[model samples]
Target: MPSETVVLLPGTASDEVFVRTVFAEPLSQVGAVLVAPRVRTLCERLTALDNASAGHPIVVGGVSLGAHVAALWAVRNPDRCAGLVLALPAWTGAADGAPAALAAKASARVVADRGLDAALAGTTGWLHDELTRAWHGYGDELVPHFEEAAESVAPTLDELRSLTVPAGIVGCTDDPVHPVDVARKWAEAIPGAVLTTTTLDAYPRALGDAVQAWQRAKG
Candidate 1:
């Protein structure tokens, strides 16, 4: 049997480095062609994946806005997707009041008004480093993606219930930005979907583990 191709996406304002660093190892165990595109809009990301997959069945996954986009795409192209791995899902349908969305909106505002340097300075603590590392790699173009991604919504509960591919949902238990409840809701809605609740302190290793297991089992 042929190996499945995997297109892992990064969160808002993040570049290929983030997703590649988090997923490259385990996904290699599956002998997958891992493509991480540097796109801002949902349509762009999906279109990039569509081109990268080269008509080969693939496992699609992403973090935050990326995760939301992956789920939405999987639903629209079930046969094209072999599996899904959603990490730190921001919100279900509308991104209204969601912590991640609000933060993205605020960052976009700062970037648009004060500029990227000021926006980077506004972040504090571990987030300061995390945001700086990803945002720096992206430069100014990432700002628009932050705003657009925050406004983008994933599939609804009804749509999730109709998903055919196996899904692996991971959420940070203590992260207000990406609620664990949202992950649980997705797991419940998608038949045979597995959910894992992790923490920010642990980084996204749990997400990688969950995806690896899902691929092994779902295969």
Candidate 2:
């Protein structure tokens, strides 16, 4: 009856701060230790996940590109994954023209051609603030990280169906970049997966709902 460990990664151009803000309290409520690694690259995020699960099975999850990476890892290492808590899943299989991917690619170009401020100038509200902090934290690696995430592939529907672990997929109902339909598709493909909807302003609820879904599935 040991407490579970939840290793979460941030979205593209994001930092551990965002992960902690969204998942830490909810995971603590369920007596799970939260590991939010501050990583700028996909490889680092995956390595963090692998390292965290080396001792025992852990719940693996992330937001957007982070979610895609975590899901891909869980598909490959089901034995080391207890469950998933995915948020704002952007796409499946090939990223291609997925809105989130396209945005990342465009942002990368802006960052490369103009500057960080120019890339972020169009964003507003909470997203603006979040990106401002995260993009700044990325520093020299921002553009490359954005490009990598833009071109990254998520777990295919077949891969998701092959997963034996429970999954909790969350989506922002009004988010254009991370379509709710994508989350729905993920939930449908994964056995015993739960789909929850919430707004960006109440994003933390998405984590709570996801954890509750996992707990329900485990029970």
Candidate 3:
């Protein structure tokens, strides 16, 4: 609707190159710009989008930590957004036992112990098959990207309670980094949020379906 411009933000250890190759190709047909801001905070990224669009209806979305940022942005700028598309949203709160936090801690350990190379190697295996291959090819640059993402967003749950945007959440059943329960909580927390599940094999399908749904609703 209204010539949607979907700004896509990638999760930790990800950058615009990955998002463009993985997500933008399919999404661009719908007239989405797929704006991937390279910033340290969600607020700053949203500010950049604001300046770029100059007050247009934007559909914000992302993966993992990026999703968390998008959700926060939607809450803060409800009127400026058309919809939210969250894929593998991470945990954000005092809930220390959430899968997201556990994974973050585990990843932190990997980075600390085995080093970034080993960490990336291990994680590349755990990612979806497509992503794993892509990451493997880009292994040389993966660590730096992950380091930048880790320093980008500081997860805080209290800040999420303020969001009230229509959202669509997509997650993998086998993804330990983005557990289903955590995704469910995010869907429940945001007003008019919808949740969908997929296996590692169906990631692209899930993403396309979610984006289409959000676009239709925005119309």
TM-score of each: 0.90, 0.95, 0.72
Which residue runs of candidate 2 sit more than 4 Å off their true CA positions?
Answer: 204-208
Best by lDDT: 2
Poorest 10 consecutive residues of model 3 by lDDT? 122-131
Predicted candidate 2 versus true structure: per-residue lDDT over 12-109, tens digit per residue: 88889889888888888889888998898989999999999998999999888889999999999989999998888999999879999999989989
**Candidate 1, clashing residue pairs?**
none
Candidate 1 vs candidate 3: the TM-score winner is: 1
> What is candidate 3's CA lDDT for residue 156?
52
**lDDT agreement of model 1 with the native:** 0.79
lDDT of 1 by residue, 30-95 (tens): 776677887766778888768865667788888887888888888888878888877887788988
Model 3 stretches astray by more than 4 angstroms: 39-47, 123-165
**TM-score of model 3 relative to the true fold?**
0.72
In angstroms, give how far residue 51 of model 3 lies from its true place: 3.7
Position 78, candidate 1: lDDT: 82
Which consecutive 10 residues in model 2 have the weakest lDDT in total?
A: 203-212
